[model samples]
Target chain A: MAYNLWYWPGIQGRGEFVRLSMEAGGIEYRDCAREEGAHALIENMATFDRPPYAPPYLELDGHAIAQVANILLFLGDRDHLAPSNMNDRYWLHQVELTIADMVAEVHNVHHPVGSGAYYEDQKEEAARAAKQFREERMPKFLRHFEAAAKSNEGDWLIDHRWCYTDCSLFQLVEGLRYMFPKRMKTLEPDLPKLIGIHDAVAELPGIKAYLDSNRRLAFNEDGIFRHYPELDAA
Target chain B: MAYNLWYWPGIQGRGEFVRLSMEAGGIEYRDCAREEGAHALIENMATFDRPPYAPPYLELDGHAIAQVANILLFLGDRDHLAPSNMNDRYWLHQVELTIADMVAEVHNVHHPVGSGAYYEDQKEEAARAAKQFREERMPKFLRHFEAAAKSNEGDWLIDHRWCYTDCSLFQLVEGLRYMFPKRMKTLEPDLPKLIGIHDAVAELPGIKAYLDSNRRLAFNEDGIFRHYPELDAA
Candidate 1:
């Protein structure tokens, strides 16, 4: 049976994380909201037995799994996106949540006021927010992730294997590059292991196939990670 | 062995969510960072092999779990804080992320530009941010949660049995009441099931014992959920 993935069609946003994990794990799934329409997502969400608080929810078998990290956790166990050991699984989640925190900060840099408001309207605050995000927050988060990757001997987060954290690190790097090109150039050198994780994930057979295909959505201004050249700096 | 929870002392903040989950589950854990001096927290994080991005990390056995949602997820699985079934566990996480979203907005109401700056530095912007949050975002989030609770069985998100989501709901209500008493009073009538979940969790056996003791921290200016009268609606 195919799982149903519901998210906005126009942009990747948080939904791309779920899509990446699914594609990497070779899971059969439908990008329902993208295939149908935004209204289909709305209707499906309403019809859900236990409604999700936001979009980017996945329906497997019959259950709808919301939250990007939670969806990855489900897929992690099912498709070997997680490490086999219990402590390994726990640490994988810690790294995943760290990725989610960065994602949230990325969104905040664009919309510091409210999601209801446009970035253009909140540009002044966004600039101030972006300064902290691009300078302090970005480096600090990258350092933590760098240390996490360094703790293990091998390239990936859990060493030798590509887990969900690897896929998320790839997205984080990709999104940061698109969002803050100038800042990423400097930060990249500070985190070689993270770059290795990114390279390894990009080389994953299924992920490579998905990225080469039309299924993968590009980073647009409509998504969480938007490129505002003015918001970037060294 | 007792778990060591490391978070800044003096406020419920992000750490409280983890505290509530452990308390509700009847798990014995120490408020490590709170007991240790603030300088110790800074030093401990500096020495951590796999560094945490922020506070509210739980050190269990020898593993350190960071991120509020992640810490709760760890305890949920270990102490039976979540439902046994896979689907129920997924839904529990879905609801928990929504609570995380709510908590985030609460933090943003005061620190509109993110926590890197002081409230005085961004007071004007924070006022506008708080207005949008109190007037728009809170209602939308509350309605989504109310619908979610209603769609599930009686009290909890999935069924009559209490889940980790219930503890989060309790924190949401407690935070809202502290931050926006007037606004929450008006919103409460419309959110019966949401309120019921809060009430149920508040009266849980372990939580009652925990809160009654000095183990539970009160909401203060130092924490995420602060009570600034101006930020609240009169």
Candidate 2:
């Protein structure tokens, strides 16, 4: 059965993470907000007895499962995008949760004073946040992911096969490159494993088709990874 | 078998969320950093083949499980702290993860320009961040949780049971009250169900004993929830 995925219409934001997994797993899903409208998504959310706090919730069977990582976890098990063993499954989840932490930090870099204020309003604070993210946080998170990838005897995060975490890592690298081009360029050589995963994921049949189609939203100022020239450093 | 929980020693930060669950569940686990010292926690983290990105990791049966929600999920299943049914269990996890999101945001209020800098160094931005958090973010999160608590037939987040999410919600309310006393005082009346859950969790036999013990670290500036007079408004 096709699932209903509800999110904000325009920007990929967090929703793209779920979309990437579904596409890579070859799972059938409807982009509810894109197909209908953001208003419809909002209305649909309000109707749930246990409503999601934010967007990127998936309606599976009849229930709405929210949170990017949580949605991916369910899909991983259902669609076979993750390892079968319990230990590796939990490991994959741990990696995804860590990726989620970095994604939150990445968003904070552009909205240092918080999301209530616009980036233009918080430019000065964003500059400071961006510097720390580039200099300290970025390397710290990437190195941990690299070590995780190396720990296993394969190119993927958990095992020989590309799991949902690999899809997320690809999105993370892509977003970082879009948000901090100079910083990523300087750091990419050190992150060969992570970069390799991104390249490999791009070549996956389903993901390639998804990326080539209009379904993959372009990175823009409205999304989580907003690019500002002032926030980038070489 | 007892588990070893590694977290920073000084404060009831993210680790406290894990502690609350273990305490309420009556599970035996050593708080590694508090007993052995923070240096030990650091040294131990380095030895993991698939290292956790940050601490609050639990060593169970020779392997480490990281991330608060992921660990809690594992424990929820293993220790009987969550619903046994798959749908309710996933819902419990969704709530816990959303609580995790708010916890991250709550920390960010004090360190809005990023954690590399001190709150003193970013007080100006902190003021802005705190205002938005106290006004918009906190209520938005608490209301969603309140709705979740009310959605079910009983007082807990799930079907009449005190699941791990309830443990987390208790901690969330406690931290908010400590961090933003005036704001929480103003907001608490509207959150009757959530406040009820918090109160109920506090009275649980294990939690009561744990809180009265010295092991329950006091909320301080060093932790995730810090009281700043300037940050709270009536």
Candidate 3:
């Protein structure tokens, strides 16, 4: 049975994290929102009595799970992307949660005042936020990921195998590069392990196929990671 | 064995959410950072082979779990604070994750430009962010929680009995009130279910005792939710 994944059809956004993992795990899933349209996502969300606060919910076996980290946790165990040991699973989740935190910050950099206002209305605040994000926050978060990777003697964030965290890190790097090209270029040399993991994830058979196909959406201004050259720096 | 919870010493902050659950569930745990000092939190984080990106990590049996949502998920089953069914547990987690999202956004309101910079340095940006937060986000998040409560037949966010999500909703309401008193008072009438849950959690015997005791830290400027008169409005 295929899982039904619902998210905004136009942009990768948070949903791409789930898509990356499912693609890597070779899990059969339908990108319902993309196929049906944004109306479908809104209608699908309203159908649930306890509807999700936002999109990127996964429906399988008559149950819908929202929140990227929660959905990954539910799928990790089933798809064998997570460890058998409870401790290892929680630790992996910590890394994923931190990744989510960084992703939120990335979104905030482009919309510093709040998501309610247009980017143009908040450009002045976003510039200040963008400078701080490109200078301090980006490095701090990347260093945390680097330290997590170095903790184990393997290329993966946890255990000696690729898991959901690895897929997320891969998307994060790709998105950051697209969003902050100069900064990522300058920082990539220092993040060898992260770069290596990103390369390894790209080489995965299922992920490679997805990347080559139209299934993988290209980075755009509408997505979480937007490319505003003025918002990025070395 | 008592669990050791490491977090910032002076403020309730994110750790309070974990503290509230432990208090409500009558679980035994030590506030290690509070018992020691800020130095201990720094030292303890450094000692971990795979150190967490930030604090509020629960250490037991030599296993450390970080990230508020991950820690709650780890403890939920063992302490009987989570639903027994897998689907319900995931749903509860989704609510908790959404609560975490609101909490993070709350923090960003005060430190809109950067957490590294002093609030005074970014007060202009923060004022802008806080305006959007008060006018938009607070209602949006509160409505989400209120809707979740209404969807279920029980008073709690998910199950009939109090779960970790209920504990978190309690904290979210308390923090928002402390940080945005005027805004909350204006919004509370529309949020009957959320206010009801907050009052109910406060009346829980364990929570009531903890609230009366010195164990519960008072809200201050150092925490996620800060009271800034200039940043708040009705």
The prediction achieving the highest DockQ against the true structure is: 2
DockQ, model 2, C-alpha based: 0.84
Q: How many Å off is the CA of A1 in candidate 1?
A: 2.6
Cα misplacement distance, residue A42 of candidate 3 (Å): 0.7
**Runs of candidate 3 exceeding 4 Å displacement:** none
Instruction: Give the deviation of candidate 1 from the true structure as CA RMSD.
Output: 1.6
Per candidate, the number of residue pairs that clash is 0, 0, 0
Name the regions of candidate 2 deviating beyond 4 angstroms.
none
Which one wins by TM-score: 2 or 3? 2
lDDT for model 3 comes to 0.89
lDDT of 3 by residue, A151-214 (tens): 7778787767899989999999999999999999889888888888899899999999999999
Q: Each candidate's chain B TM-score?
A: 0.95, 0.98, 0.98
CA-based DockQ, model 3: 0.81
The C-alpha lDDT values of all candidates are 0.84, 0.90, 0.89
Model 2 error, position A189 (Å): 0.9
Encode model 3's per-residue lDDT on B37-138: one tens digit a residue: 999888888777777999899977666789999999988977888877888888988999999999999999999988789999999899989999998898
User: Candidates sorted by TM-score, descending order?
Assistant: 2, 3, 1
Docking class of 1: medium
Greater-lDDT candidate between 1 and 2? 2
CAPRI grade of model 3: high
